[model samples]
Target: MTDAAPQGRLRARSLGVAAGALPTGPLNAITDVDGVLVGHATVDDGADLHTGVTAVVPPRLGLPAAVHTGNGYGKLVGSTQVDELGVLESPIVLTATLSVFRAADAVLTYLMRLRPDGLSFNPLVGETNDGFLSDIRRRPITEQHVLDALEGACGGLPAEGCVGAGTGTTALGYKAGIGTSSRRLVADGAPVTVGALVQANFGGVLTVQGTPMPVEEVLPGVRHEEPPGNSCMIVVATDARLDARRLGRLARRAIFAMGRVGASYAHGSGDYAIAFTTAPPQRPPLPDDRLDPVFAAVMDAVEESLLNSLFTATTTTGVHGHTSHAVPYDRLPIRPGTGG
Candidate 1:
């Protein structure tokens, strides 16, 4: 696993900031789960365009999947079919709010070419409003952007902070973007991995390790371009033997952990979590009693992943010269063992 600081920024863990007691996978990323692949297509024109597409590709087709909505104010395409049929047919695509349908169509186009004989396909797509830093009305994302993300899918540590679907995102009064983390644990006598990737674009006080970050006190009149609430899209992947029902339960916990980082879940915030398992049980599934560890792992991974998003993101100036500053560690008190 390479260092989590991909863009000359520090990851939360690098500052000794973390959540929960569970150990992380080698890369501490969603790709830590074997066979899971992630890819991104960044459309930064250094002008009005600051949005892009992100793809989360599972190991195989027809995997058991589920969706949990914390607050359903934003668009999450293909969710009804995923909930009704309990399966994800195509790679999960994420982009700007207005670009969701186009991104879904791109996913459909990508899948149709592969399964030429198949009649119908359900493409999972989710989005958050990036209007503050992006000219969202322009709908800059293209079919090629979504397709490139799908085709460029790879394993290993994925990029984070101000990239892909997170390119124009803001959170907790600061710049935020794609972030990921994974946990390793044993369930029902079998080892399993649970990984999470988050697009942090919501609003709230920034909290870590039970302490609220003093964004106002430190920044002293920082730009608050976005409204009170926006949205956050979470994708949770695991190798545990869980079906749609179990995955739905898992998805709920991922959303619940948003409070760990002070997510408002405001009226307009669209908070959704999607959970899927790469390995469905061959024999009888692990009983419900064995799911406690996995549940704890999800909460921990989600909390840390959100923090990673903020810590690794740099100050960004977007459309109209509106700026969202990075977490000012130099002025703020956030450290390994103290409040920030």
Candidate 2:
């Protein structure tokens, strides 16, 4: 979390924000984790296509990584290999449900071109169906879109709310999009940073810091609706030395933030979390006992990031004139004086 604000984008911290005891890094974004970069390719082609791609490009490929499935209902490409082998060979990508295979192939193209000699790697692509607001069957995402996100990926505040893969997403009956937050921490005398980024496309009662904001009450004309099987894709990054096993545990803690924010984790919701460490491969892994601080940081950062998604988004109208209203700023029960 840098002293420089996200230009003018509103975040949870903007309104005198505090999610937990730990302090946030300068950027207060997932980019606070050294070497972790983010980029988005938003597609808005008139009425039919209102979806795109988001890429979380790590400094190096094949970093020690792991994925934890909060619910087993997603089209997460290349997850099994990472689960079995415990390493991520590709950048993490998020997109609409039908575009997953295309996203995977695009990454493969990016890799083979980069490693012309020879390359064997599994591309991790996570997806959430955005049919309610977009024409998903077209699967409009293309290789160019993935490459654009990857090539342009840089370290800084990632544009959130109704952008990239979140362009057509709806969460808790409100318009939801990309959201991010990070924490600065010390473990065993070693300084570490933990950050979370999410594609919040799921459902639940809207709650911020234990205070509830039912959809009907906040969005004047919006009706209460819970579409089954929607999803959320969570990415957790840390500079702490950790192995794939420990990363799995950390990933689970990241998903727990969904519950804290009132996520349904419903049967149709494909809730998944993937985590990685940018610590050099040669460094010793952090002790398990020292991980309590890391867990708290993850939960706090993730909860706030989800809130950021809702706060930053604008009301959107997509396919067939279907609309998803943004969570109104005036109506939110924000800690007085903290909201923008």
Best candidate (score: lDDT): 1
* TM-score against native, each model: 0.96, 0.95
lDDT of 1 by residue, 1-340 (tens): 4455778887777776767888899999999999999999999988778899989999988988999999999999999999998998878888999999999999999999989999988889999998888989899889999999999999988889989999999998889999999999999999999999999899989887777875777688664555434899999999998989999999999999999999888989999999999895575566788899999999999998998888888888888888888987664345543521
| lDDT of the structure predicted as candidate 1 | 0.88
In order of listing, the candidates' clash counts read: 1, 10
* Residue 169 miss distance in model 2 (angstroms): 0.6
In candidate 1 the C-alpha lDDT for residue 206 amounts to 87
lDDT of each: 0.88, 0.86
Q: Which stretches of candidate 1 lie over 4 Å from their true place?
A: 331-340
How well is each residue in 1-340 modelled by candidate 2, as lDDT tens digits?
4422242446776665568878888788899998999999999876767799999999898789999999988899999999998998889999999998999999999888888886476889999998888899998999999999999999878888888998889898788889989999899899989999999999888887787888887766666666545899999999999999999999999888898888988889999999999999899998999899999999999998898887777777878678888777677666546532
